[model samples]
Target: MNAKIIIVLVSVVAAAGAIATFYSQAHAPLERVTEGFETGYGGWAPDADVPIDPNTGQPVDWYVARSTDVSFSGTHSLKFFIDGRQDDGTIWIERKVLLREGARRVNITFDLYSGEESFNTIAVVCAYAGFKDPEHEGELTVLGPANEVAGWKRYSLAVDIDTGNAQEAWVAAGISVRWETHMTYYLDDIIIEVT
Candidate 1:
C-alpha cells in the first residue's frame, strides 16, 4: 500500500511539472523591439509637417479623414476604421533592432474582421538596420499587393539578411490605401514575431 501511494504521488508531480513547462513555453513573451522608433500620423492636416505622398497621396504621418482615428503607444495599439481598406493616418509604433546573417523568420500578424476580399492597399515591411546612423544599412522589404487577402490573414516573411556592418533594424511597415478608397475596414492586434 505504501509503495503504491508513493508511485502515484511521483507521477502526479511529474505530470504537473511537464504541463507547467509547456504552458510557459507557449505563452512566453516575444523579444521587445529596439528603442526610440515611433509610429507617425498627421491627423488630416494639409499643413502638417509630414506631407502626403505625391504618388499615393496617403499621409506620411497620422492624418485621418472625418470620423477616423488611429494611435499606438507601447504594446497597446489601436486603429479605428471607417472603410473597407485601411486608410492613411493609422500606424503602430516602430523600433530598430539587429538581425545577424542567417535564416531569419519574421512573423507579421494582425487581425481583421470576417468580410469580402476588398482590401485594395499595398502593405510594405521595410526594415533598416543601423537606422540610428542609417549609413550602416541593413534590409528593406516590400511585402505585398495581395489580392485574395481577406477575412483575417497572417503573413510570415522569411528573409536572409547577410552578415555585415549592418547592425540595426528599423521597420516602416504600413498599409497604403489610395484615393477614393472606401469600405469599412478594421485592423488590430499587430504583432512582430521573430524566430
Candidate 2:
C-alpha cells in the first residue's frame, strides 16, 4: 500500500482500539462492593433463613436461603450457611451492579469467617446467573475454601467469560457458601474488578 494509505489504516486501528478500551472500562471499573442485599436487619445469626447481614445490607454470600424470615442471631458479624448433607437453604440477594458487558475480566473476592472450632472449606462461590440457575447447572463458577482458622482472609478468583465469540457476552456472577448442613459461615466485602 502507499504511505498515505498506511497512515490512514494505522489511524483507524488506533481509534478503534481506544474506543474498545473505553467501552470495556466504562462497564466494569474496579472496586469492592456489596453489589446488592436487604437493608434493615443489622447483622447475621446462625441457621437463620435470612442469611444476609441486615446491618451491612448485603445479600448472603451463598445460595438464596430457603426463606427470608430465617435469621442469624450471634457471631457479631456477617455470616453464610448451608443445609447439612440434606443440603438446602439459600439467600437470594438481587444484583446491584451488573458486570459491565465489556468487562475485560473480573476477580470475585471476599473475607469469610467461621465461629466453629474446625470447619470444612467454605466456598466464596461465584455463580454467573446465581438465583436464575438452579443446581448451578450451566453456570461458570469460582470457589474459595474457608476451612482454615476462620477469621478474615482475602480470597479471590479471576475469570474471563468465553462468550463463544458472540457479539454480546458476560459471565453471570454471584457468590455462594456451601457446607455440611447446619454449618455456620460469614462473609464480608465481596468485590468485582476489571484490570
Q: Could you say which candidate leads in lDDT?
A: 2
> Candidate 2's residue-wise lDDT over 13-132, tens digit each?
999999999998666554334422245322212222324445466533343232232223222324444533333233322232344334455556555555543555544444342223
Candidate 1 Cα misplacement greater than 4 A, ranges: 1-77, 80-93, 98-107, 112-116, 119-142, 145-150, 182-185, 193-195
Cα-based lDDT at residue 25, candidate 2: 62
Each model's lDDT = 0.39, 0.44
Task: Please provide TM-scores, in order, for all candidate models, with all chains considered together.
Answer: 0.40, 0.46
Q: Flag regions of model 2 displaced more than 4 Å.
A: 1-78, 87-96, 99-102, 117-142, 162-181
Give the alpha carbon lDDT tens digit for every residue of 14-121 in model 1: 999999999986555333332211243311111111235566776443422222232222332233232323333223224454554442444444443223554544
11, model 1: CA deviation in Å? 24
